[model samples]
Target: MLGAIYLSQEINPHNVMVNQETKVEQEGQHFFLRSKKDFDLYPTEIRIQLGGCEYFILLNGRIDDREHLFQKLSLDANKSVSDTYLIGMLYQKFDLEFVNFLDGDFAFSIWDKQKNRLILAKDPIGIKNLFYSVDSGSVIWSSAIRNILHIVPNQKVNSAYIKSFLLDHPIANESTAYENIYRLESGEFLVCENGHIKKDYYYQFKIPSITYRKEEDYFQHFNQLFERSVHNRLRTPDNRVSIPLSGGVDSSSIIAMAENINKKDNWKYNIATYSIVFDEKEADERKYIKSMLEKYNLKSTVVYGDEDWNFKIDFNVLKELDEPYPLFNRALASKTLSAAKRDNISVVLTGHGGDHILHADLNYLGELLKKGKIINYIKDLKQWKNKYPLHQILKQNTLDPIFRKTRLEYPSWLKKERFADMDLSTILTKRFEELKWDSKTITAYFNTIIRQTGHEWFDQYLSNPIGVERRYPFLDVKLMEFLAAVPPTLKIRPANNKYIIRESLKAYLPIEIYGRTTKGNHSFLITKGFKEEWNRITEYYDFKILTELGFVNGEEIKEYCERWYMGYRYDLYNASGIMRALALEIWLSDKQDII
Candidate 1:
C-alpha cells in the first residue's frame, strides 16, 4: 500500500498535489511518497543519503533473506536494520542489478536523487503488485489501482483491455484497464531517468542444460526446494498462520510439508485451515479434507458453497479492484477470506500456481513430432490415448496450436464486426511462434509467469481490505525454475499429472491425496449460484452500455441466458463467458460513475 509521484528534471515537481496522509513533502525535490498505514507492515518508507546519492524506498512485503543479504553486502548486523535499507545497500553494491539476488513477495520502487533516476520492480512471481502511469516524463505509481486513479481522476478506459477481458484473449502483459496506466509485470523492472523510460525483464524462464544421474535425484531436489519455499513463507509476527486447504494434492501436500517441518524443527505454531465445501457430490471434497485434517491433527473452518450462493454486486469491491473479476468464484473466495479474518488470521498460504507448473500436458507430443522423433511421439500419444480419446489428444497437442483453434470461443451473442479490425487470429497464432521452447515448456511458462501474474495480483488486491496476505509455496521462483528444467516425462505419466509431486511426497501425504486422480470442479458452484440468482442477474441483461457501445447484442444475450435458465447446460467456457460479460458490464457503468 504505497503511492508516489516522481518527476524528471524536465518536468515541474511543484505542480503536483497528492491527497494522502503521512506525506513526504520535501522542498526542492521532484518526488513524494505516501503509504497507507494499515497491516502493520515492516520497513516503512526509508530515506537515506549515501555517497552523494539520496535514495527513497517503499516496500509492500517482507524480504526473506535479510540476514544473508546483510552479511553479503557487508552491513553491520548489530546496526538498526530494515528491509528498505538492505535493498538500498544492494543497490549501492550492484545498482539496478540488485533484483537478481532478492527473494520474497514484494513490489518496490527506488529513487536515486543524484542521477534523477526512478526504478519500479515487482517480485519474480508477482505475489505483490505495482501499477504506474507515465506522462510528460513523470510517473505516478501505487500498489493499488484505485490509489493511482485518485491522482489521475480523468483517465480514459482502455477499450483494447476491455475487449480482451470480455473475450478472454491474450493481450499485452503490461496493459491495464486504464489507457495510460500500465502494470509492471512480474519479473520485470522499469527505469526512468533523464527524460527517458525503459522497461526490461530482470528474470526469464530458463532450463538448466544438465542431466540427472537418477530419477530419485530429481524427487529429492524437488522436495528440498519445496521445503525451503514453505520454510521461507512461514515468517509472521506471531507464530500463528493459516492455509486455504482444498482436499487436492497441492493443498494437502502443503499441509503435510508444513507439519513435517514443524516437527523436524520443533517449532510449533497454531495452524488454521479454511475450506469451501460443496453439497454437489462431483464438487465435494470433504471426505478427503477430513482425512487431511485428521491425519495432520489440524482444525479447519468450513464455508459451504450452497449456504453462500448469492452473486450480488458490491460497489465497494468493484471500486477497490478497479477491474473486471470473474464472477463465478468471487463469493466463495470472499467468504473464505472473511472466515480467516474472523479468526484473526493475517497470513494464509494457498495451493495456487500448482496446476500450471506441476501438471504436465501433451504439448511435448507435438514438439516431438516436429523434431522427427516419430517413434517417441507415437509411443507417448498411445499412452495418453489410454486416458483420453485420440481425437482430443491430437487436437489439444498438435492441431490446436497449429491452426489456432483452441482460443476463446467467440460467443454468437457478441458483435462479430467489432472483432474484425483487431486481427486477433494472427495475434493468437503469433503467440505460439514467438516462443522457441518445446511446446510443453512454453505452455507451462506462459501459464505460470504471464497469465498467473494477473490472477496472483487480483488475489492480493482482494485480500488487502480484509488484512490477509496470501502466500503461494508453489509459485516460488527457485522451485519454478527447477520444475521448469524437469523433463516433461517426469511430470506427466500415462495416467497422471504432477508425477513428480506424487512420487516425491508419497510418504509425507496421506494415501487418499497421493493416489487421487480427480480434482474438484467449481462449475457446480457456478451453475448453482447462477440458477438461484437468474432473475436478479438478468436484471442487467439489458447491457445498455455494452450494447450501445457495439460490443454485444442485447437480445442475443437474453436468448442465451433464457436457454440456460430453461435447462440447457452450456460448456464451461460458454457459461463462464456469461459471467465475464456481466462483470464487465457492471464495471463499465459503475467504474465510470465511481472514478
Candidate 2:
C-alpha cells in the first residue's frame, strides 16, 4: 500500500524525510515513496524502473481485469518476466492515454527522465485522489494534504477558500484550502516538465439515451452493470466483504445483489453488514434491517450512534482528516472503517453516490427547454405543480437557463458583505467557471455531487485514516454512464423518482424497502446531538484564531451560537450553520502555526 508519492525537482533533506516516524524509500531521482505498512491490499504495489523512466502504481482496491490485462499486455508486447505489464503497456503507448482503460481505483505516476516529463493520474470516477502542489520548480503530490504541508510548512491558508466554505461546501475541482496546492478532479491527469505544467481531463459523462429503446432492456443492462461492479469490488483473496447497510433501497439493494452474486457464482465469501443504532425509536430502522439480515443470513455488527457524542468538539481527534467537515455523518463512517479493519476487511462498499446518481433532479425540464420541447415541458410542469406549488417548480426548473448565463450564485452570497474581496476569481479556478457555464442539466447534477461536495477527496480521506478502501457501486463508471444516458421518463415519471432502480430491482429487493418514498429524517438525531454537543462545545468555545486571521467576525458568531442554543430561532439549517462555525474555529485553531 504505497499511500503517497512526493516528487521534487531536486530533493532536499526536508523533502526526502516524509514524516517524523516512517523512513522514506527512494524510487528514483527526485521521487520518494511512502505507503501504509502491514495492510493486506489487492493489486499489490507495482513499481518499475525501466529505460530512463520510472513507473509506480498503488491500489486501495482491485482492478476489474488486473490479471487478464497484465497477461494480455505481457503476451502482446513480448515483455520479459522481470518487466511490469502496467508500466510496459504505458511505455509502449508512449502516452498517458492508456490510463483511460483502467477500471478500478488507483493513483499512478510516471517519471520519464529522457523526456523530462511526468504524469500523475487517478481513476475516472475519482474513487482515488491525487493532490499536487508546485513550489520552487518541484511538483509535490500525495493522497493527503497533511503530507504535502509537512514539506512546504510555510504555505498560507487561502482566505477565499474559507469564505467559500462558509457560503457553500469545499472549493470545487482542483483548488485546495492552501494556495499553490491543488487536487486533480475526476478523470483529470497532470503533466509537468520543462518548467511548464499542464492538466487535462480524460472522461466526460455523456448520457447515451438513444442507444437503448426498451425499458426492460435498460433494466437488464443496469442489473448486469451493477452486478459486475459489485463483483469487481469483491475480488479479494480474503473471501470477505463489508457493506454499510441502512435498510434503505440503496444499501438493501446492494445486499440483495451481493446475495445473488454469491449464489450465482458459487462463492462463499462472508458478508458483514454494519448498521448504526440510536436510542430513539424513530431514528432506528430495525424492522427493515432485520428482514435483509434474515433473508441473506448475513452477519451483523451494530455501533451505537450516541446522541451525546462529543467527538466533534474534540479538535485533537477531529484534526485527523484535517478538513472542516460537518461530523454528523462521520459518526457512522468512522466506526464502519474501524470495524472493517478489525475484521480484516480491506474493502467496504457504501451507498454514498446512490442518491445523486439514481435520483434525477427536476432540472431536466431546463434541458427540455434547451431542446425546444416546449409542449413536453409544459406537461411536465403541470405534474410538478401538482406536487409542489407553481412558484417553487417554475423558479427551479424554468429559471435555470436564464440564471445560468445572466448571473451566478456568488452575488447572493457576496451581498452579506461578511468576506474580503467581493470577487471570486481568487477562490474558484477558471475551469470550474467553465464547467458551470458549459455543462447541461445532466452534467450539472453529477458535477454538483462529485466535485462540489468534495466527494472524491472527502471519501478518500475518511478511509485513509483506517487503511481501508471505500467503493460506491452507484459511482461505478459503467452504471453512471448508463444512468446518465437513460431518459428522464426512466429516471422519474408519474411522480416516481428513481423509477428505473425501483422497477429494475423490484423482484430482488423487498417491496417495503424499494417502496419507500421519503428519506429517513435525521433531524431528530442531529437536534439531539446538537443539544448535547453544544454544552460541551461552549466549554472551550474560542474563535480568537479565526477572528485574528480575519476569517470571521468572532462576536457575531458567538451571538449566533448563543441564539441557536437559547431557542430563539433554530432548525436543521441553523444547526448546520453553528456546526460549520464550530468546525472552522477548531480547524483554524489547529493551524495556528501556519495561520
Candidate 3:
C-alpha cells in the first residue's frame, strides 16, 4: 500500500531536522515533516523560501516533472510540495478550496506551512483511497489501516460494526471493516486545524438541463467527448498499457481507439490486451477476442482458465478492500493482473463506466420514452417498434405515458418500492435508510454499482507490482457531464442500446462487434461455470461455518446446494442467497471477537 504522512510540530524534531547547525544551536523552528513508503518513485527533497517552508514527499510511481507547466501554473518553487502535477496545480491554483477544479482518481494532502493549516481531499469517484485520524494534538493519515495502526496505539475492532457485517455482507459508509478508522467517502474533503476536523463534499454528478436536439448532433458530441477522454488516459508514454478486452463494445471501443491513436502517432508501443477464456463454452469469448486482435494486429494474451482456477478465491489478497464484494469475473481479472504484473505492466485500461453513462440500459431508455416529448417519443417509438414486435412496442408506449406523467410525482414510499425489487437492502447496508430517495440516490446507486464492480476488478490490479494504476477512460468527468446533458433517447434507442455510441464508432469498429446484441457475455458464462462446479464449491467451505455464524439458515442453504447439484435455476437464486450468507460469514470471521 502507498501512504503519505505529514507532521507539524512546534519545532523540527531531531529525526526530521535537516541541518546539523540547527540541531547543535537548538534553532529548529516550526517545520513540516513528511514520510512516504515505496519511495523509489519519489526521492527525498527539501525547498525553503523567503515566505515559508515546503516539504515534498513522493511514493508509489515515477514523478512526472513537466517544470514548464508547473511554472505556468505559478507553483511556488521555493516552498512547494507536490507528487503529481494535478495535485500540485490544485493546491497552487485554488489552495484548500481547490476540490471542485480536480477530476481524477486521486487522494492527496497539502500542508500549508505558512498558514499552519492542513488540507486533504479524495477523488470524486473514490478511486484512489485515503483515510486519516485527528487527535487532540496530532493528525495522522495512511493509505492502509495497518500503516496507521503501526503508529497509533489502542487499535481494536468495533464489535457493533462487526455484528452489522455478520448481518449484512459489508459494512455501511459510516463504519469500516475495522474500528475507529473512517474512510473519506468519494468526493469528500477534510480540513484539520487545531485538532478540529471539518468534512465537506466537493463533487457530485449533476444532471444537466435536457436539450432537445438532432440525434446526430448528440452522437457527434458523444464521439468527440469519448475520444478525448480516451486520449487523455493514453497521454502517459512508454508505459506498457493493457486493455481488459471482453469483446464487448465498451472494452472493444477502448482497444480500437488505442489502436487508432497508435497508428496515427506512429507509436511503437504495443498494447497488450487480456481476456479470460474458461473451459465452459459460454464463458469463453477467446475466439471473438482473437478475431479482434487479428483484425487490428494488436499484441494480445489470452488467459485460459482450468477447473482449479475456478476454486481460487484468496480473500487475503484483497484484505485491504473494506467489504465482501461479489467475486464474479473479478477472480479472473485478479489472475490476469498477477500475470500482467509479472510482465511488468504498470497501467491497465478498462471500460467500466461505459454502461452506466454512455451505454445505458433499456430501463433508462424506458425512462426517456416515458417523458413523452412528442417528437422524441415518436422517433424512438418508430425505431424501437421496427426492431421489436408491434404488440411489444404498443405495450411499452402504453406504460411510457404513465411513467412520464408520474416520474417527478413519485412519493418517497413509491421510490423505495421501485428499488426494493433489486434487493438493495441486502446489497447496501442500513445506510440506504438514512438516504433520501431522489435522483441523487438513483445516481448514487448507479455509480455505486459501477464502483463496486470496478473496484472489485481493480483489487487484482492492485495486488501485483504495487501501485499499478488502473485507468478508466469511460469514467472521465467531461464525458459523464456531456452524457447527462444529451437527451436520453439519443443515449439508448430502440434498435440497439447505446445506439448513438455504436453509430459514432461505425467507421472505427468491425460491423459484427458494432451490431452485437449481447450486452454482456460474461454473466452467462459465470453462472454456467458456477452451476457446473456447485458441488465442489459448496463442499469446500464447511456448511456449518455459515450456520454457526447465524448468517444463513443452514438447512435451507444445504437444500439449495443440493437442488443446485440437481440442475435448477430456482436453486440458482437459492445459491445466491447462500452466497450472500457465506460472504457475510466470511466477513464476520475477519472481525475481532466475532468468530
State the displacement of the C-alpha of residue 493, model 3, in Å, after optimal TM-score superposition.
3.2
Judging by lDDT against the true structure, name the best candidate.
1
> What is the model-wide C-alpha lDDT for candidate 1?
0.73
Q: Tell me each candidate's RMSD, in Å, in order.
A: 3.7, 4.9, 6.7
Q: Sort the predicted structures by TM-score, highest score first.
A: 1, 2, 3
The models' CA-based lDDT, in order, is 0.73, 0.64, 0.54
Give TM-scores for every candidate, taking all chains together and pairing residue i with residue i: 0.88, 0.83, 0.76
Q: Which pairs of residues clash in candidate 1, taking residues 3 or more apart in a chain or in different chains? A: none
Local distance difference test, candidate 3 = 0.54
Q: Provide the lowest-lDDT 10-residue window in model 1.
A: 426-435
Give one digit per residue, the lDDT tens place, for model 2 in 1-595: 2233334435564534643322234444354445544322444445556665555544344456565566655554344342234644655464666766667766656655456566777677776667778776567776667767777766787666777776565655676778777877777888876658888887766665446767899889888888888887776567788998778888998878888998887867777888876766666777777877877777679877654343443555555555566564565558877887898887788888787777655666766776788998898887778787788767665665446553334422123555645555433322232332223646666656556545664565567557777777787887887776777667776556788888888888776676776656555545444455676666445566655655555666666656555545344454554566667776776676765
lDDT (Cα, 0-100) at 542 in candidate 1: 82
Writing each residue's lDDT as its tens digit, candidate 3 over 60-110 gives 222223354456456666655444544545455566765665655566665
How well does candidate 1 score on lDDT at residue 506? 89
| Model 2: lowest-lDDT 10 consecutive positions | 429-438
RMSD of 1: 3.7
